[model samples]
Target: MPARDSIDRHIAYWRAEVPGLDPDVEGVVTRMQMLVRHLQRRRTEALGELGLLSWEYDILWQLRAAGPPYQVTPTALAIALDTHPATLTHRLDRLTRAGLVERARDRADRRSVVVVLTDQGHRAWESAIGSQADAEGLLLAPLSESERRTLVRLLRKVVLASEKDGTELMVVPRSVQRPEH
Candidate 1:
């Protein structure tokens, strides 16, 4: 077995299988991993600026951008984020206590509840979003305008492909019911 860092695995694989492959693959992948780590750390810092956790920001952002009324069931958030039902409920409870969101019975179905953002929640979310965008922009500043556009298109294709049918596409104002065991 070759030592982990011995000739780069990416280079070895491509060189062995395909002829005249670009050498940038190893450099790109390694740089991407570094960028991802740095971005995740900056993301945590950015969200914390609004006194919110990563999960908290995700939920609020989902509701706000989810179109008019900006709300969706906990189940929907879970599915979109690939999280569990129990985990989503716990997060909802935390957000509710912070007054960032509220859970109310769905008018059409008494047994069902919807999580809605409050006024304070909206302001907090706006602050978080602005900071995040600024941070991400700075992170990508190294890339030229054309590079940025190309990167965005490539990344979006990968993201959309992975999530295509993983969750309901509808933007709903209601959530799945959670009854105590």
Candidate 2:
């Protein structure tokens, strides 16, 4: 398992110490919260070494892996990244200047623009993939193969459930839907 610190040890302590709680939410929800913290911290650190923040890496990686026009509308991009228009606009502006991402006319909607990954961005992403794999392997090394499959199955159930609370996860649709236009 990846090195555990005092923070990991104390997470359960704090969970148990919550002053008042709903039984159902307190279990799975709190565990998810703590797990997210652990995951994000390591992910940020691991991804940072490549000189790319998670959000920036995420945007570029999505565009590159899309494997076609290598372009997507800003709205569609925002949905993929779980970000807002203003936030996407700001990041795109930065990436555009860095020559990592480019803005091009959207053939589908003349009024809209699309983000496409540039050559440099694709090369950087290729270099970063190894680091990303290393980080993910370390993060998940604790579980056995069967346990990993079981955990993924259980998490998929929660992720696909309809949202009752308006939370950050609202950005992620219960399932990606493709409708004929």
Candidate 3:
């Protein structure tokens, strides 16, 4: 059996102090939250070393996933990132100043603009992505290949079930879709 971690101790303390609590459920949820926080912090630190912020890395990644010519409308990018338009505009401003992204008039709709990744942006994004992958690997190093696969399957089950009512809002990016053999 796997050894108990901090969440195990936490659940024990909570269960003793509050008799009605379900330690199994509480431990799982708490551990999930703690794992997310840890991953986020690790990612932030990794990106920092490359002189990139999380949002910047995210935007570049989305554009990169969009494939060649690497551009998307500001509205589309904002939607994909789950961010407010004003907030995205601010990020775009910073990226533009950093020479990572450029805002250009959209050809199809002259009234609107498109965010395109510059060459420098691609280099920065690639660096950040490599760093992130290394960081994630380090985080998961304790898990064997089989364990990682099982964990991914289980997490997908939970996430998909949780998306029941919100399926319409989900965006299945092309990069994640399986290709034909």
User: Candidate 1, which segments miss by more than 4 Å at Cα?
Assistant: 1-22, 153-181
Clashes in predicted model 1 = 1
What lDDT score goes with residue 13 in model 2?
67
For candidate 2, what is the lDDT? 0.76
lDDT of 3: 0.88
| Candidate maximizing TM-score | 3
Full candidate order by lDDT, most accurate first: 3, 1, 2
Per-prediction TM-score to the true structure, in the order listed? 0.69, 0.65, 0.85
Best by lDDT: 3
Candidate 3 — number of clashing residue pairs?
A: 0
- Provide the lDDT at 86 for model 3: 97
Candidate 2 regions exceeding 4 Å error are 1-29, 79-86, 107-112, 160-181
Against the hidden true structure, what lDDT does model 1 obtain? Answer: 0.79
RMSD of each: 8.5, 5.4, 2.7
Model 2 residue 23 lDDT score? 50
- Against the unseen true structure, what C-alpha lDDT does each candidate score? 0.79, 0.76, 0.88
Sorting all predicted structures by TM-score, with the top scorer first, yields: 3, 1, 2
